[model samples]
Target chain A: MKTQKFLLTEQEMPRKWYNIMADMPTPMEPPLHPGTGQPCGPEDLAPIFPMNLIEQEVSTDRWIDIPEEILDRYAIWRPSPLFRARNLEKALDTPARIYFKNEGVSPAGSHKPNTALAQAYYNKVAGTKKITTETGAGQWGSSLAMCCAFFGIECKVFMVKISYNQKPYRRLMMETWGANCTASPSTETKAGRSILEKNPDSPGSLGMAISEAVEEAVSDENTKYALGSVLNHVMIHQSIIGLEAQKQMEMAGDYPDVIIGSAGGGSNFAGLAFPFARDKINGKEIDIIAVEPTSCPTMTRGPFAYDFGDTVQMTPLLPMHTLGHNFVPAPIHAGGLRYHGMSPIVSQLILDNIIRPEAIHQLETFKAGLTFARSEGYISAPECNHAVAMTIREALKAKEEGKEKVILFNWSGHGLVDMASYASYFKGELADHDLPQEQIDAALKDLETLPKPRQGGK
Target chain B: MSTFSTAPPSDDVQVRCPRLGHQVHFGYCRAENLGSPCFKALDCWYLQFDVVGYFKQTLSGADFAAAFVHQGRPKMQTLVDLIQQAKQGTPEEPSGPGKGSA
Candidate 1:
């Protein structure tokens, strides 16, 4: 195969930044800024968003109703399509029926907008003028920017510097939608200032960006903070994705034997799997797998404990599978999945053994991404490559077993912005790293020090 | 698609620029990468995402009347400057009176 380079020029933004926001319920406990030790409220987030959105962030039970007005706005991309990948099965020479929920059809080119729109809508309803957030690979930032634009809310994004430098087009998409995008650790925030004072050339991390964004939101009165993944409300908003997928599968007259999604902050995976989990709880026999990067294996390796979501304690301590808050993942192309912690809901499900977890190296994941791109004609994000790897492995297993297993997965986002990583991989330049057991053990020890939740209580 | 009449606005103030020497912007600053002069002194926070595009556009456009104009060497320097400025606030521009400046 001929090698291709996907480079962006000056005038074009990635197409993923044109999605709309939908209505979602508010979270119970909003994250607080670590430096100020103050809870981020609706007022702090107003500059970037409308006041109506601020009120929605705190509406706990608002998920019960799907407002007609909101539905009208979301009808453009609300119910994404699910496909049965018969061609993949034919290529693998397996009797297994394969399926995938295509999130790339959405304007943000990922399932992220399913929840971004909801968060933005809720924040706008609450009267917030702006929304502050952090992004690793720029999907979340682009998604939020699209949503904020639709709602006439201002968006301020603190993007991880590595991704900010690597994927300039992603940032452009945010800016095209009128978002004020900054690379973290920005001098605008104290956390950013402290990190810079320590290392003049520190490559910013997602945790650091989260700390900066949280600080900005908590300190301001007109802006309320918004997070893309890993909160009950976020997961709840994302549930719409799975709900729509279930209906699509039913329409196709197919039932999946296994479901797979990649785990980052866990919103996309949860959005694809949670509705299915509801069925499993009621005696549905389905296997669900959450894939993670072996470099930062929060599920297969990290310990289950209470840890601050951000490096600075600007966020609440949630009981989840975490590789210490201070853990800075090695620079990997799959920036979105390099988070040090998994979503609390995903952590709880893994603890209960209701879902399975697997980790793969970057090389293997990228190879799977290449194969899928050749067959499906859509280059998936490196983070979503984890899910593709697991799906391919499961399909191979079915081929060996000569069983007709039904496998389904979520193709989370397109990798047009990640062509550089693919260019490196095809040239056999991709390198993999294994965190030393000693470092893993030390992170585990830190996990032990966190306060445990009371028995049977969250 | 609008053609440049004279020069585009110079909102190219980065948090840190080697030429500017501070985190904040005061007046007409060259973009960290393209040297395309901007009238707005404050760092164009949006440029972080559009650097490649901006460089390509500036190099291709007829706006040679702008501030900085180099091919590739200063592009990386501009990125480095942006990173540095991002970490350290611009000394020239004040951190807008704690909200309500707009």
Candidate 2:
């Protein structure tokens, strides 16, 4: 298949990129080398993590406490607004009140900086020299690179091959941040070489990129791997978004009937829902829903089992909701949501039935995203559009039920980096790829290899 | 030392902690139904048990720091430790909640 690329004139460049990390609390855990298990020198992590993770624990009795110094340095486009979508409610002719926490204002244009700054900060403090990571849509990579530039850390990003080929401007953005960007499945590592040996022109998946990134970190003694999502610390760091939003909602004198977020490795969703989940656990009656692409329904369709988090299986087996380690999802425009497994914490919540999960098609999600962009003047990431679709559907149901409902969702990212996807959507050029049942079964079969529980409890 | 493939005819895989210089027999652990220990040295799991007890006991402050940092990498390990600590002696705590063999 011939790849389609978008060309943008200099004037077409986005006027601003918001850095929301400045206003958020830093994370507690610092960066350490995986192999050495030692605190990395600032120079050690300089290659991979160009920024540090600031630490802050969520407080039940008070609003989040963001340090002024960190905020001043990192908050280029922070204090993101929370909008009450009265017009959207009127369009639906429903009594449901819809509110959105807009994170599209940040540079790199997503909720990514919430952790990027924290990761960069920790790396800087640890004296690590650099950071290395993989990005699908380039938001996480660009966001990390931007944070690194701020901290004077070196950033290296292995972008997914297809996205790198299709989204040159995203690569350029990383370069603008002084990050060295390379397309995955390039001749950088043994893993990439092996994959390329099989299919020279294969459009790489996030799993493939993860393997490359891990390989880079494992091979290099100085560098540590920085994941954008899936880990607990990342979610913990991202909770500032939920913490702030919870405060902002209180300021608006409204409580959400339902909280929505799009899940890809589940960090953004957890970032928005964890605080509310705390409330729910403590007797708050609210619905928390996670929206994912049907193309990679790890929570909804996957088995809750112990599986290797990475394709190489170098990492320990984590018990989570997984579509198996080998499941390479069909390419969806919601590139961030195409991972094989959800975060362990998010998976546990879904397994325990604390949160509900729904999967949506790409076409419908993009349509909903377009509707939201036209209405609100901010284009959402394709992944974020899943929440938009779910919100619209719920609002319509509320109208039918004649019930006044309050809906709040995270506009986790902007689609400015996703103009190619929108162009495809407008030109009627996008199509959703559904994996064959045979392939899914093949992947599921690998789950049987996991170590099983003994016959009797000791 | 054998490495097991995800494919059929399952065998054993031996893994060594590069930092601790400890060798763990993954197959033996599976056969004996033992859970993987948390990487953090200060955690109860680390204090109470060892993956490879054959190592000479030399617990130092540096070792503790190393394990603590290693534990930070996998967020699940810390969470599992926290939850286990919270549920210790509580009726709600599952018997083997987060054990890999479970």
List, residue by residue over B28-97, the lDDT tens digit for candidate 2: 2222111222231112111122422311243344433232222212333322332232223221111111
Worst 10 residues of 2 chain A by lDDT: A2-11
> Model 2 - which docking category?
incorrect
Evaluated at residue A422, the lDDT of candidate 2 is: 69
Worst 10 residues of 1 chain A by lDDT: A17-26
Tell me each candidate's RMSD, in Å, in order: 14.6, 15.5
- For each candidate in the order shown, give its overall lDDT on alpha carbons: 0.59, 0.59
Q: Against the true structure, whose TM-score is highest?
A: 1
TM-score (C-alpha) between model 2 and the true structure: 0.65
- lDDT for model 1, on a 0 to 1 scale? 0.59
In model 2, the runs with Cα more than 4 Å from the true position are: A1-69, A160-162, A183-222, A308-316, A323-331, A431-458, B1-102
Q: Per model, how much of the real contact set is kept?
A: 0.00, 0.00
Per-residue error for A144 in candidate 1, Å, reads 1.5
Task: Report how far off residue A392 is in candidate 1 (Å).
Answer: 0.8
